[model samples]
Target chain A: MKAIAVEPGAGDPVVVEKPVPEPAAGEALVRTLRVGVDGTDHEVIRGAHGELPAGSDRLVLGHEAVGVVEDPNGTDLERGEVVAPTVRRPPNGTNEYFERGEPDMAPEGAYLERGIVGAHGFMAEYFTSPAETLVPVPPELAELGFLVEPISITEKALEHAQAARSTVHWEPESAIVLGNGSLGLVTLAMFEEVLDIERTYCLGKRDRPDPSIDLIDDLGGTYIDSRETSVPEIPDAHEPMDLVYEATGYAKHPFDTVEALAPNGVGALVGVPDDWSFEIDGGRLHRELVLHNKALVGTVNSNRGHFEAAVDTLASIPGWVTDDLVTGVYGLDEFERAFERNESVIKTAVEFDTR
Target chain B: MKAIAVEPGAGDPVVVEKPVPEPAAGEALVRTLRVGVDGTDHEVIRGAHGELPAGSDRLVLGHEAVGVVEDPNGTDLERGEVVAPTVRRPPNGTNEYFERGEPDMAPEGAYLERGIVGAHGFMAEYFTSPAETLVPVPPELAELGFLVEPISITEKALEHAQAARSTVHWEPESAIVLGNGSLGLVTLAMFEEVLDIERTYCLGKRDRPDPSIDLIDDLGGTYIDSRETSVPEIPDAHEPMDLVYEATGYAKHPFDTVEALAPNGVGALVGVPDDWSFEIDGGRLHRELVLHNKALVGTVNSNRGHFEAAVDTLASIPGWVTDDLVTGVYGLDEFERAFERNESVIKTAVEFDTR
Candidate 1:
């Protein structure tokens, strides 16, 4: 079986040969069809984030995955059924968070993400997972099913952002996404189509004629160049934002989002930045948050419920939008193209098999 | 009528004589009884914060007030009724926040806090306010009704902190208050008595025999001397906190509170800090918040609903606790004693008239 693997503190991911995995009791063997590459994958390759599996030198490198159940092994899943595997699994086989069906809320060292940290991922041709960890995906959407994982992240982030205002009669009219990456564009689309936000904006440093910005315009969203106007100055440059979705992971965006918010506004933080120390007006930020009745909620990862929600969101998004997002889908023999970074690229994936 | 007034950027408050005020069509003339002094009063005196009423050189200084309605002037309030006045009023004739019955959520400049910012306070012997701004109080609570204003501030903060967890099943077992001032002590008592939080803690940097420490001990809360254990170190020294109530306006406490929270914890920030610049590990704090599913909510002034809630909270507290909190109740002639800051003082107020 062919698999994608990365050596911590080493170079980029490479194609490796490994034996096919067998399903244990109450487990299902899956034959991979598609796997997505994201920012976390880049970080894991650079040694800035994620841990290698215990006693293993190289870690498998895919979490956003979709496949067919090759063997159900007497589980609820049926043979040849399409499914998407969730990333997080209890590290010690049990914890309060896992017991509560909220593994996404588990603290560090309590859970391991397959292909992310402390476990092997599903970038291989064959992988085995507990039957319950697999979420059934509609067979007709197999071509785009790999996206359910990334979309789930946004689903969880928005869930928390809305939860912050549950006590108030909040009707958010405007929103801004702090990044122009694939996730940002997808979230901006969700903001327009699902949330029906009146005014939408996305921030990026890209020049005109960029596909990402074009997609924003196609979705009726305005694109603000970061070099021209920063996050904190957005209120004066445009309008006070009712919701600020931060996906850039820039250390300053969190503070800036507090200032950009209108009264009773909430900001959802999803980016994970590296160690960076800087000077900030702590008192001013604190005063802004307190005086404005603003809230900031930090979220990462997603649970099964979010993934279920993501399926519907993915289904509702126009086909052309997803078509524009996936710029390249490389086969195992030419896997290098999936890891390539280019200005024109929006989203990339590695194809294991079509059927 | 005699009043306590401060000339902004000048010096401490001084006694001034003015004509008794007349109530407008929908206004009520209140005979001030007890007006509590707090940190915001100190800031207004130092010219560091707050605004003087338009076209007025001096600002009357008292917002935490309880009084008797001297005249109803064709309003819903009855004459001779005990009431506590809310502080915030729309700066303009009206705003959306005020229209929605949420003046506390109004942004800066949209609202004026009576006595604290753009309007005359209740420190005067006679003050005029719109009848709707006064919340009726039980006559038996007249001696302790002045505490309602400050208690309502905490009420609003806790409301927001709890609202942040509305989406999840949160049972906060342990809580910590990050200050030992009057507000901190009152909030600690509320956590134990009202919220029924177990394993309460309060942080202060005072020597033994301190009155504040004694009150915390009386409430069955552990006292953490901040000099011995910093805010971020509370998790290791004591235990990870499920709820962190920040009352000290120290700029660093906000960031430290994020680090001190347990997984799925939420923090409520109530203190207003002055403009100060500081260095922090922005990346680590951001990561901690996102990965641990933590949230931070900032709250300031409270609405009438919170004041009504505070009335109940105040009545439920033991009489000895409120008695021990109000260290002094100075008359007009000895008003300086109420503004004095010393080691033994827990809470202070100025009495305009007993009847």
Candidate 2:
């Protein structure tokens, strides 16, 4: 079997040969079909963050993956069926969150993220996982199934945002995305496909003619250039936003988005900003939050329910959006090319063959 | 008639003569019995903030007040019935929030606070307000009724905190109040009276034997002298907090409190900090918010329902606490003495002969 491994602290990654894994009872052996390359993967590769497998010098490097079930050892899953393996698994021992089927809500260091923390990822040719951790996807959408993980992130965030605003009769009329990356585009697509929002906007630093902007425009959403227009000035230029989805990973955009919200607004933060300190008008920000009844919530990974919802969301959206967004697909030998930054690239994947 | 007025920009305040107000249709002529003085009143008097009433050189300086209805003017209010008047009123035109009975959610500059903004207040011998804005207090608790307005502020903040955590089955066991001011004392009282929280702590810079600390201790909650301990060191010294009610108005306490929250905690911010900027570890703060499933919500003035709730909250609390808290009750001529800040004073009020 071929797998990509990175040293824990060393920012070097290479493809190496590994023995194929076998499924234990109630587990399934999944042959990789395609794995999405995201920012977290780059972070792990650069040794900025991520944990190594226990007693191993290296960690496998992919969490967003789709695969074919080659062996369902006494499980309900059928052979040759498509599935998206969940990234995180509960650590050995019974935790309250894991027992309640909410491993995502587990406290810090409680659960191990496959290929991210203390376990192997799905970038290998063959991997074994508990059958319950595998979510079925349509066979006709094998390549596109890799996106379910990222979309699930937004699904969980939206679920929390909806819950936070449930006390008030809030029906969001206008929404804005604070980033133009693939997650932002997918979030905008979800806003169009799943939510009842009417007006939409996506803000990014890129200029016009970019695929991200074109896709936003195709979804009947406006694209705002962040380089030309500042965030605080958006509400005045357009209308005060009801819902703000922030994915820029900028330390200041979330605060700025808080200022841009209308009365009774909610800001859903998915981006993890850098360790930078900047001066903020604490008084003014406090006033906006208190007087206007605004709420800001942060969400990271998704639970099984959110992933299940993401499958439905992905299936309902027009296929062209996914086809247009997943701009590049490479092979095992060309895996490094998938990590390269390109202005036109929305998403890229590394496909696999089990034969 | 006599009223306390402050020159908008000048910090000087004095008792001045004014025409007695008459009740119009659906309005009540209230004979003010007691006016509780809080920090916002000090801010208004110091010229740090506050707006003058239209076409007047001076602004009446009180928002936390209790009065007796002298003239019901064909409204539901009865003569000699005790009432607490709400501070904020809707703007001239019919705004959506005011129409929907949520004047507290009105946009900035859309609503006018009675003493803090462009409207006159209830610090006079007589005043008139729409009968709808007057929440009735039990005639038995006349002087104690002035505490209702400040109590309503906390009631609103707790409501927002409960709403934000409504998604999860959160039952907080321990809580902490950030400041030891009048609002903090009232919030501590409410936590013991309204919620099922067992362990409680109030952080303040005051020395022991202070009335505020005494009240907190009497309520079976611990008092932490913040001069000896820093904000971030609280949870380490005691225990991680599930609910943090911030009323210190210090610019940095809320951020440090974010670091002190336990998993699935909620911080209800009712404090309006000064215009000071401080450096914060934005990355760590974002991680805490995302990973721990914590939420921080800010709340300001309360609406009619909150006032109604506050009335019940005040009634349910023991009479001795209010008696100990409202330490000073000056006559109309000695009203200037009410504004003086003294170490022994927990709450000061101006009383009038309304009988």
Candidate 3:
């Protein structure tokens, strides 16, 4: 199997062949369909992510994947049942996050030990995972394999947005997406699903007349050229914002969202930035950061429940998306091309065939 | 009547004669017994506070005071009853706090008014206020008439600590106080009232072994001389603290205290500074803040419910207080001596009817 591995710190990634993994006790083997490329994949490959497993140099990248069970299937998973693999699996096979009641915080993130940081990944023909994590996908999700992973990410993000603000029922006055990438577009999609936001603003360079911009318009999210407009163009620019989620791996996203928030507005950080050290004045944050009392939270990878909810959201596509954000689908052999044009591809998935 | 007044923009304070105020409908005439002199009065009288009302030069300066009712012989407040005046009145009141379901944000604060900033205050022979603002000083409060307002501030801070943190119980692993002034000591007392924190450290200096330091020791708090020793002297100074309340009107206090918070520890900010705007890195705070999802809060003033809660705590003070915190009493004419060497007087109250 061929895997893309990155050396520590800003280094070029290398493609190397590694041995395929065998299912251990309580684990199951799967035949890969397609792998999804995301911001996290780019981050891990650049060594900017600290959550990377120890000895990440040997890590196999790619957490967003779709597959079919090849070995023993758990009660929830079945052979030939296509499904998006859950990224949050307890590595020690125990409840490491029992205290926090969140699974993504498990010391062993899904990326590591298997294929992310220290483990073998699914950019190969075969992948093995804990039986408990191998949830079944509906048969209707065949051609839409790798895309499910990205959708799941949005599910996790929406879950996070709801938890930080209020009950999921409360919609913000307006929603803003700092970037226009596939994840950003998807984030808007999910936000529209849960909240009755009066308007959604999509911010980023509209380099060309693309479908994403059209999708943003279709979703009722007005496009904003961040380069031209100063703040306060919006009604309550410096006031409390009901909700703001950062999907860009850019470090400035948090600061931008924090400044744009209204009092008691909640800022949810879902993007994993390339820079590890983030600095700001504690005094202002203690003072102005919370006008009427707002919250700033980091929602990393989702737990199983979030993934499950993401699936439900996926099944019910809001009226906005017309399949514009998802563009390319590739085989495992196109790993190099996947990374070469990651930015251009809204959502590219790896499709696998099992004989 | 003799009153204290200051010019605008950081000027000198002087004791001058002023006209007596008349009671209107729903208003009561209070003959001030002991006027409490704390940082608020010091700041207002020096014209260093911002919330001052325009043309505040004719202002009578004092917010914390114990007084008797004179208007209705048997007004809502008895003629001989000792009480604290709730500086904020309704409609056009400086302190805009009123309960709608619950009290919203504090109105423009008590000190920023005419006698205060633009409004006249109580550091005089007589004062005018609405009948509703008087909080009856319970019979059990043997002495320390003017300590009511400071105690309310402390009570509000503890309530904030309770509301923002995860646990409802005050007795977390331990609690720490950032300063040991009147505000700091009162905060310590309020915390002790709620839970028996394993160890509460009081960090500050005393002119002659500060009165608050002695009270902290009596209440089982370990006092630290922050002026002499750096905060790092304590073990795990970099770790998150169980609960830390910054009673100091300085940024450095809360910054250092935030470092000492244990996982999920909360730092409550009640202190307001004179100069400089505040800022915080939204990304770093979300990542490195409270490990168990910690939070930091800023509480403005006591709401209606908060005032009620404050009186409840004051009524339950043990024998330890009189023997420790309350050191000496002063006559109204000795105001100069009390304000000059106030540090020497652990906690002082004035004798109004010094006939």
**Residue B132 alpha-carbon offset, candidate 2, angstroms:** 2.7
Provide the overall lDDT of each model, using Cα atoms, as 2-decimal numbers. Answer: 0.91, 0.84, 0.60
DockQ of 2: 0.51
lDDT of 1 by residue, B1-355 (tens): 8999999779999999888999988899999989999988999999988999999899999999999999999998988999999999989799998888888888788899988789988899989988888998899999788899999999999988898887676899989999999999999999999899989999999998989999999999999999999999999998999999999988778888898999889999998887899998988888777888889898989999999999999999888788878899999989999999988999999998876
RMSD over all Cα atoms, model 3: 5.7
Q: Best candidate, DockQ-wise?
A: 1
How does chain A of candidate 2 score by TM-score against the true chain A? 0.96
Q: Summing lDDT over every window of 10 consecutive residues in candidate 2 chain B, give the lowest-scoring window.
A: B273-282
For every prediction, compared with the true complex, DockQ reads 0.74, 0.51, 0.15
TM-score of 3: 0.76
i-RMSD of model 3 (Å, 1 decimal) = 5.8
TM-score winner between candidates 1 and 2: 1
Off by over 4 Å in 1: none
lDDT tens digits by residue: candidate 3, B40-79: 6666655656345554434556777777776643356667
lDDT of 3 by residue, A271-341 (tens): 65432444544455455442244445544565556566666666666433626666766655665666655
Arrange candidates by DockQ, highest first: which order?
A: 1, 2, 3
